[model samples]
Target: MKNEPLAYRMRPKTIDEVISQAHLVGPKAIIRRMVDTKRLSSMIFYGPPGIGKTSIAQAIAGSTQYKFRQLNAVTNTKKDMQLVVEEAKMSGQVILLLDEIHRLDKAKQDFLLPHLESGKIVLIGATTSNPYHAINPAIRSRTQIFELYPLEEDDIITALKRALADSENGLAEYNPEVSDEAIHHFAMASYGDVRSALNALELAVLSAEQNDDKRQVTLEDAKVCIQKNTFQHDKDGDQHYDVMSAFQKSIRGSDVDAALHYLARLIEAGDLPTIARRLLVISYEDIGLASPGAAARTLSAIEASERLGFPEARIPLSQAVIELCLSPKSNSAITAIDQALSDIRNGKAGLVPKHLKDGHYQGAKELGNAIGYKYPHNYENSYVEQQYLPDTLKNKQYYEPKLTSKSEQKFAEIYNNLKSNKK
Candidate 1:
């Protein structure tokens, strides 16, 4: 315990001491409710690293008198789980914190399922990977899933100050002088990872030159300790999808600043392909009919981005994102197609009208195909009102133009005119 890192040593002994994640451990929260009622169940905690997944598990265990054990799913063998099981048998119940639970192999999972069912092990599984996608279904089905959020800057600062004041498990014994600038640097540079911030604070304090009896830590010391910023982006993780969703949503919601912000994050990740595809989809799906030309321009921008690649590609993408954010939005086209698809899927489709059927065959007239088909080209304005849909669906209407922009308003007028003529 004396040689353990500051982060491990400063682990909260109770739920109340855990920093941030009030949503989970708050008094009225579900986990706290479970603790209060002593109705513990197997659950999985998932999010980015250094976000109190293990700490929350420990706190929950500490809140109860049950035996607590910790193990890594990857590093620990099945035999390690057996040891916990043996202890559970003796103690009646054990709270087991399994780290990297997404990597739990089938063998270990098979061994744990029966115990999980028997209520002998109240498993608290923690993983940076999303449990739904990464964990085996057998284990996932038997556990409640909760997502942990990153610690805010204030939360990190609060934890850091607490660590400095904690003498027993923290750095209060050093009596080092830490500047506010240094603390701010640690809070910002670590990017919501309190563990990284605390360890860096420890490094700065331990390695700094002593000013008589006190070592004064500075922003320069904080910078050297945390050499690289942890921005917390995983290409295959939830953050990637989250950013992509926000990017399109911002554009649809017509917030240029927000759209650009998410675009910048995607650009920073160098995800040109995903950006290009999402932009193309947004052009038609969100801005359809209202600004048809914008969709064409977005296509050109995507082509330019693909040809130019990243860095330079960001220029075109940024321009396109700005234009899209400002573009008038409509989803009429997508809505119309989806409605038609739904009807077809639900067996609403009927036989094609005989007059609209192909009449090029030699025996077409005998079968009544195209017998009464009046060519619209021969009529005034290349328009004629006649039944095009099958007799059963002759009254079906799908495309209802959302008169959002001038272009869509014009389309709506024409559509209404044709519908009137049909009646």
Candidate 2:
């Protein structure tokens, strides 16, 4: 126990002690309610690393009288699980904290399903991957899924303060003097990872130069202990998708600063592909027709980003993001297309007009294809009125032009004029 890492040693002993994740372990939360009722059910907690998935599992185990067992889905074999089953048989019930439960093989899953159903083994599967996406549906269907968010800076600070004052399973015995700056550095630099913060604090305390028989941990010491600041930006994690969503929404909402902030986050994650793709989508989908020039510029920026690659690529990307955020927003184009698609999907489409059908085929003029097709280019002002849509949708209006920008205003003028001419 003395040799154990500070994070493991200081793991929350009960749900009350668990830091952050108030939504899960708070007094009025569902997990807390279940615990109070002593009617614990199988659950899977999914989130990014160091956000208390295992701590919550351990805390849940500590809150109950059930024999607790920990295993890794990948490292532990079916035989190891059999031993756990045997223990469950003798002990009546067991709270099994299966780490990386997403990786559980079919054999182990099959063996455990009956026990889970019998209430002999209450599973608390912990995984960093989204359970709905990574876990087998068979096991997933049997468990309630909960998401754990990254710890807040204040939460990390609270954990640090607790560790500093704790004599047992903590660094209180060292009598280390940690500055507020150092504490804040540990909290913020860890990026909501409590385990990383605690481990770094422990290292800073133990390795600091002794001052007046006490080790004084400075901000520099904290920085040295935690060599690199790691942000919670897994490209495949929930936070990544959330950031991407916020990025697009911020641009759509015309919040330039917020849009750039999310852009910077994506850039930091080195997700040029996602950033490039999302920006292109925003240009055409949200800003379409409102500022066609901006959409064209966005495409150019994406091309530049792809050619230049990151670091230098961020310049064009930043310009594009700012332009998009400040540009007039309109979803008219996407809305129009989607409305048209919905009509077609719902069987609103009828046979194409004979005049509109392909006349370049070998049928020649006898088939009557394009027999009366009016060529607009040969008419006055390159304008001609003819049946274009299918007969069923001849009067079906899809493109409702919004008077949001100068360009779209012109489009609306031309569209309304054509409608009047058709009448």
Candidate 3:
């Protein structure tokens, strides 16, 4: 029993036996429709970890008359894929299920593309990443993509109850009774991962029996089991959102230490490299010129992460967070641009003045486009008097620099000089 994995022992054998995923099992659902009509398409299931993608694939095969073959993208090679294709050809109607399909490299993905397109095999690929981005477009185009959302709290509760009461593979022998409060606690902690909830329930039941309290599994028992097991991160769901929210808020609030802590959380949780890179873009877009170097430093960290990968790349991320938090905060430049755009959108479609229309000033003695545009680089103290703004907005000010540090002081001076010269 110790040698056997819990997932293997409790694997759902039939569509009726499976828990959660009612959206796919509901009346008139695609899977149900296919099962009824005896017609299944080459498709992909995209979802978070432990969300029943593989279980549903197996159930589909079990429910249908087609011969089923399983392949793991992590271990199966191009040769294995070809052999499967050949077998599928002989079998007439065969369903080939590929687990962790995103792990397959470009060459392996390309090798399967032709077979997928030709419908030599009914393919069911499962991934924890977004198939649109992770899968080869050619292969993905041939397969219908179905998104499996994380289990809701109520769905998780139902799954937990089913696992506890099922005689074949659950804790039926112990007849353990779990409280509603305890179930709620476990569901919340599971972060919408049914597998995690089941595992935790199984461990708690075992622990209760070990402690001579086999009649019931309480919140205390559940807590003990959770504490004993390593806190696993749910990368594609709730935990991911929770940690990222903390990270972004920490940066916005200028708490460098807290920001770094969240960064570490994401890295330790095995977040995708592209996702980490995207956070850098947020650093620039939201925390921009306020910290002039924040965007640049974040971009540099992104590049380093791409080159060096995790564990080692976290150092640059930490550095960027600290620098951003310490740097002066300002969004005036962004605000100015956004406000101008808003004005344009609000029907402020002011046309170009006759004097500045087209290239009318290209050869004019009044300096044309260059006229009224101050040459600050060629004036007293590198400053010049000019009327550069459109006449309608001649006195309007947009960017109001903050006096956070010496850099901002210089920016303020330049802004003032430009405004003074315009008068």
Candidate 4:
């Protein structure tokens, strides 16, 4: 029996079989039109790993019935490019799929540019990085870049079903009995990478102990093969920033479920420092005056996590996450500070009023420091409104407490009473 992996064997043989990327491969799509007319062009495929960049290129070549070749930008040299060009010169045309094109060196790129310009070799550059930021501008300008999104679970499940049933180039000959739980596990845990799903499925079917002369793939086997496929999230990459952004926004939006989901993802990856820093920031920036005690609570939780790190840290971290997510939120503290900062940065600052300046020292009285200062303890409610701000800034109010949260509402009432006392 041929021992090719299912991912390789299940490569889409036709455009119709290419899963996901409906915007590119669906009916009357631009790529579909290009293949149908055999009017191939130099293009770049950009997205996460294993979203079928190579498979789509292959499908396009198969549909067009054109000569196809593939090379890795990391391994292929200028000499290899020359060899492909030599062959294409005889064939009159060829479709070249260059994997990790972001890694294309200057020499290989310079050699390929002319061929791409002359239409002798249709270059399909695939990269996991953003081409605009990673690829040479000249090469990027020469090719139409199509971004392939990660495959959704539904798209991956459909592909898995096809692989399970196909008689040729699939496991139909072995008659594998894959449970629905196994299928769901594979579909969801692949983390939007169909290639990962197929490979794990194939491995589970081939490696499992056979029962009744048929391979049986269980949920445990699927998990063992792909190990939850929790997405290779780079802690310092764009995804990390995105997760942090979502985490904060979820808390602000009061979506406890989403907040907890992001919390678990971060915790699972052992990103405790960011989690620690982000939790404190959210408590102040989001919860703010709405829940004044939340900051202390969040800090207590973080301190607990610090005392016991990692696997145990997540418990206290989760506790803080749930409380913050469910808490009332306010931005008054941030608004007050930002407004004060804006004034200090601009020309709105002034000298402290004489009455508000230090008068405790003996000479301070001689400078008229406490000359007009009112002693509020003698008054009813023990509160008096005098010119606490500088003469120029007497009307400048920085802290405008909102009523969105209970603490802020209490502050509003106190402010109103103070204003009444002033009148």
TM-score of 4: 0.79
Clashing pairs in 4: none
Which of the two, 2 or 4, has more lDDT?
2
lDDT of each: 0.90, 0.90, 0.74, 0.88
Query: Candidate 3 or 4, higher lDDT?
Result: 4
lDDT, ranked from best to worst:
1, 2, 4, 3
**Candidate with the larger lDDT of 2 and 3:** 2
Candidate 1 whole-model C-alpha lDDT, 0 to 1: 0.90
> C-alpha displacement of 32 in model 1, angstroms?
4.0
Most accurate candidate by TM-score: 2
Q: Candidate 1: lDDT of 403? A: 77
Q: Write the residue-wise lDDT of candidate 4 on 1-423 in tens digits.
A: 558888999999889889999999999999999988888889999887778999999998888888889999998888888988999999888999999898898888888889999999999999877787789999999999998988988899998999989899888888999999999899899888888999998889889888999999888998898876458577855567778999999989989889999999898778889999999999999899899999999999999999999899988988898899888888988998999889888987898888878888889988988778888897877877787767787777778877887788999898777766655
Model 2 misplaced regions, further than 4 Å: 361-363
Per-residue lDDT tens digits of candidate 3, residues 286-370? 5655566667777877788768877787777777778766666666667778878887788764645444444444466444543
User: If scored against the real structure, what TM-score would every candidate get?
Assistant: 0.89, 0.94, 0.62, 0.79
RMSD of 1: 2.7
What is the Å distance of residue 45 in model 1 from its true position?
A: 1.5
